[model samples]
Target: MDPGLLYDLSMNDYLNFLCVSGYNQTLLKAFSGAHYRCPDIINIMDFNYPTMTIPKLYGSVSLTRRVKNVGSPGTYRASLRVSAGLSISVKPNVLKFDKIGEEKSYKLTVEVTSPGDDEAFGGITWSDGKHYVRSPIVVGGVRGVFHVLDKTQFIDLGKLHQQLNLEVRRKRRSKALSQIAFVGVLCQGGTVDCMK
Candidate 1:
């Protein structure tokens, strides 16, 4: 807090001190100077879906791209790419931007082949023959058999047996049979019924 200490502090040090002192508003205003402004060449959407469960075959999502600065005012191109284990096709994979602030959207179709639950990740890259940037893309899907287990740990079966009724036990057995039938259908490609 000494007055002489301020003279030795650099611009970054001053901003860091302001930020650590909880003067976030004042820190942002100080950093938003004209000299801090720079041209943004390209901007793309970031995929942040924590978990997306999709069925087999096809799942689609729309991706958006925008040209923040069209330097020479010519054609700029962008393309989409996906990770392995997933077949992806982008409608209008190649995008053209004529001017700055021009935005375009593309449809991304993903074909899930494997039956196991998995996640896919990739990115889209845009370039103007001089500068380029890649934005991340993520997709998650579940195929084949899926299971949902109950929290039976809290219910002590030994203690429940004394108070359990036939109806309650039958209902639990019926639920288990239905799950088994679903798994059989997915794995063997045939309908199964434990009740029958």
Candidate 2:
């Protein structure tokens, strides 16, 4: 490492650095608690369970979130929203804080009506009707009723598969020939179970 390449920052300057790049996984660990960047706002502390996975989702699940309003004299409304195949209910959703560091525990009841669902999305939000503070959520179960994951930027397997199928159709193969050969090849490759 070159000495000249490294620059040191004061505590205040380091905090500002965190404000800009705190979401980065590496920086979040290096700086410890990046949650202090905005002190005059509601803080969702110990948000360790942002994403959860269940092998087989059946019936419903109960979750609790402890929240504290670090800002002085603040009042906000908390709510829970979920996608289809699931629902969530929050207890004592409204919050009123006259003093700083007013802590409250919110009970969340998550119901998964359909066990066969592959995935669903939801979130918890605290809003003052001016600014919306949100926490994202993702839940997953078994894969594939379909051939692909929702296409992503880094790897467009789904789109590529569609394109190749289009090309094959243009080639004019007979009904006896294989259709969507890529899917068959992928299944044979053993990464995904074709039997499922």
lDDT of each: 0.42, 0.52
The 10-residue segment with the lowest total lDDT in model 2 = 1-10
Off by over 4 Å in 2: 1-56, 142-196
Tens digit of per-residue lDDT, candidate 1, span 44-97: 221222122232322333433222443544443556576666655666656565
Minimal lDDT window, size 10, model 1: 1-10
Pairs in clash, predicted candidate 1 = none
lDDT of 2 by residue, 19-134 (tens): 55445545654666444443333223223243333333345555555555555456668777777777777777876767655666666666665544367778878766654656
